[model samples]
Target: MAAIQALQALAIDVMLPALGNISHDLGVTNPNHRQLAIGVFLICSGLGSLFPGSIADRFGRRPVVLTCLTIYVALSLGCSLVSDFTALLVMRGLMGLFVSGLMVMPMAIIRDRFSGDRMAKVQSLVTMTFMVVPMFAPTVGQGVMLVAGWRWIFAVMAMLASALLLWVWLRLPETLDPDNRQPIMPRVIVGNMAQVIRCRASTGYLLGAAVMQGVLFGWLNSSQQLLGEHFGAGEMFPLIFGGIALVMAGMNFINASIVERLGARRVSQTAVIVYILIAVAHLISLMRGEGLWVFVPFITASMCLVTFIGSNFASIALQPFSRTAGAASSIMAFSRLLIGALLGTVIGQVYDGTAIPLFIAMAIGGSLTLALVLYSEKGVLFRRLNPPPLKVKAG
Candidate 1:
């Protein structure tokens, strides 16, 4: 489940280090336009997320995911072979579409068995495993760039997806419930998805997560410029990128250890409050003309808080359903990718050779997230709406 999900991360992060190479080699003249690669993929990903869940709900999860992975692998190779920048973006969009199955199927499978804080705990573990890709993807991309052209990065992605396809085909068991087989009919798909949007908790958390995702995407769209140029990290870009990801992964590990006991509400809520404070501090430091060391800690800390916020929010959003979990996850992923990509593009396009835009996104996103969550809970915070999961003994 984790590895399949990490394919999305690998797709995004691994290409980041090569954005400059891609832009130059592809004859992209404007620096800001390089982020179009990310924007296109993400926007298509959002659009694509709307369907894979419903499709998998109609079909079996295993067949849908295996089919998508095969397409993903093919598209990666096609992306490598593309000469025109427009063609590359087109192929990247298709890659995102195919990979949406990988993104949604795992969540649907997980929701097959768990809910509440137990679901949050499991999500944290999955996220921890997922974070390993972000931690190393840039470094891997950099290494690949050293040995060959940027197109080979896509080649590498194809190879990795092929391996994952083989692994899933051999080992992954079907987890979709026999009784919960949803139909692919248009009205049924709409009705199932409508439930997710109608639930205040699910809708609120999904919107909040979309805000947070935009903040993360803003950084990704401009990190090469912000870290390597603005902060003068130079060749240390991958190390710094990898380091922040390690912090995010570590926090997810912590979340996994304590979420069931502390409750997902408390831990994630506290993290949000702290995230707001860190964003505020980060903005203040930027005004003071602080250097890279001062900048890194505050930004990294804010990102660390996201690890706490993201998965817990997801578990809460999906808590209201079991049979329709695919619909819920699809809507959430759609908001995060589609809305977030547009917002991030705005931030990236406005980049003025500084970290200011990214931090501003963080501050606004954290504040807005707090507001949405508050409204979702009737102004309540940090209290569980569900009781702890009952312990089960082995049969």
Candidate 2:
């Protein structure tokens, strides 16, 4: 799971330093178009999730994941070999298509094995591992870019994918029982997705996840240019990125430790409000033309809160659907990536060598998230305050 998340993080962060190189090489005049390359990958990856739940239902998680890993490897190689930027972009989109399964299958496997508070604990553990990679990815990508050519980034990715393929082939087991497996027919696929969407508990958590992911995705779309180009922090980019990531990593650990005790709903609800406050403060500061140091710490805090919110919300949203793990994961993952990709593209386009747009989007996304959480839980924001535990009465 960590490897898959790391792979996803590397897809964007590894390309940061290479943006200029790619722009120059591809003869692209607009730097924002470079952002499109990243955005396209996420869009494809999100759309790709629509099919895999049903496929997993039919073929089982092991084969689907293995197939995805193989595709990720080949596409990574394709990315390395592409001569033009357009070809590389196309290859990246293809890579996302394959990697969508990586995001889905792992969660399905976890759900296959755990439930309720136990499942929530397991989800937090997996998310912590997933969080660790993004924390260091930018730094690692920068280190590689300094010593190797941009193309070598893809080469490293290909190698990593190949190694992971070996790991999967050796250790990953088929968790889906034949009796429980659903057919992969189109009607069944659409119906499964519809069922997930219609479940209010699921929908609320999914929307919360989407909003949290959107804030992060919007920041990612802006960060390379925002930090490296706008603030002239080119050399310090990795350290700054990693520092904020460290804050988020610490928060993830905190969530993992406290979530089962406090409950996922309470933790996530509180975090969303905290995210909103931090984002609003940052947005105000940017409007007032704050310094890089000022903006950096505030934004970092907001991101940390977002990380906390995302993990817990996912746990809460997914708690009710262990029986349909593959389909549930597919729905949530699909929603997050779709919402994130759309917002990322929008935020990337509005970049003006300023931090205002990024913060504005963050604030809006945070507000939207808190609203959804409130609606989902009958106008309650934090489960800690009221502690209205959801009852699963015996039939």
Candidate 3:
């Protein structure tokens, strides 16, 4: 499952170090236009998620995921072979579309087996392993570029997908029970989605997740530019980016260890508050003309907080759906990716050769997420809707 989740990150982060090469080789001159490579993938991935969940709900998790992985592998190969930037973008979008199942099916599978704090713990653990990919992806990309060319990066991804495909085929059992299967009809899918949307807790947390994802996607789209253009990191970009990813991986592991005791609500809410505070501090540092030393740590810390919020909010939002986990996960993933991609593209376009826009966007995102959470909980804060098990003490 972690490997499946890492496919998405690998598709995005591994290309970071090679963006310049890609732009040059593909004749993409505008920096913002270069960002569309990532933006288009995210948007298509989100839109692609819209159907897979319902399909999974009707058919089964294993078949849907396997089919998607096959398509993803083919598309990755297509990307490797593409000669033009426009063709590559189309292939990337198609890759993202098929890869949407990689994002949605795993959550449904997890939900099939666990719920509440236990589910959050499992999700965090999976995310911890998934986060490890980003920690090394840029460095890997750089290595591939140094040895070969940028096109080989896609080739490597295709090989990796092939391996994961075999792993899933061998080890993963179909988690969707026969009793829970629904017909693959538009009206049924719409009704299931409507149930998810009408639930205030689900919709509220989904929006909150979307806001947090917007911040994340914005950072991703802008980070390479910020490090290279503003900080003049150049070759050190991958190493520095990997260091921040290391922090996020560590935080995800820590969240997994403690979430069962403290509860997802408390941990996530506290993390969002801390994220907002760090964003404010980051903005202030930028305003004061602080150097890279100050900026890196603050931004890195904000990213750590994002890990906390992401896993917890996702678990909370999907807590109410057992039979409808596929549809629910799809809805949440769609909102997060599509909205986040659009918002992140906007943020990336507003890049003024500084960290100000990214910081402002993060701050606003954190604040908005907090508001949505509060509203979802009826003005309550840090109260566990599902208390921890008796073996675990609430912190």
TM-scores for all candidates: the values are 0.97, 0.94, 0.97
lDDT of each: 0.87, 0.78, 0.90
lDDT of 1 by residue, 158-200 (tens): 9999999999999988877766789878999999999998888
Q: State the lDDT at 36 in candidate 1.
A: 94
- Total clashing pairs in model 2: 0
Q: Each model's RMSD to truth, in Å?
A: 1.8, 3.1, 3.3
lDDT of 1: 0.87
Model 3's alpha-carbon lDDT is: 0.90
User: How much is the lDDT of residue 315 in candidate 3?
Assistant: 96
Tens-digit per-residue lDDT, 222-333, candidate 2: 8888988788788788778877877777777777788778877777777777777887877777887877788788888888788777766776777666556788889888
Measured on C-alpha atoms, candidate 2 has an lDDT of: 0.78
* Sort order, lDDT high to low: 3, 1, 2
Spell out the clash pairs found in candidate 3: none
Scored against the true structure, residue 375 in model 1 reaches a CA lDDT of: 76
Which pairs clash inside model 2? none
Q: What's the lDDT for residue 53 in model 1? A: 85
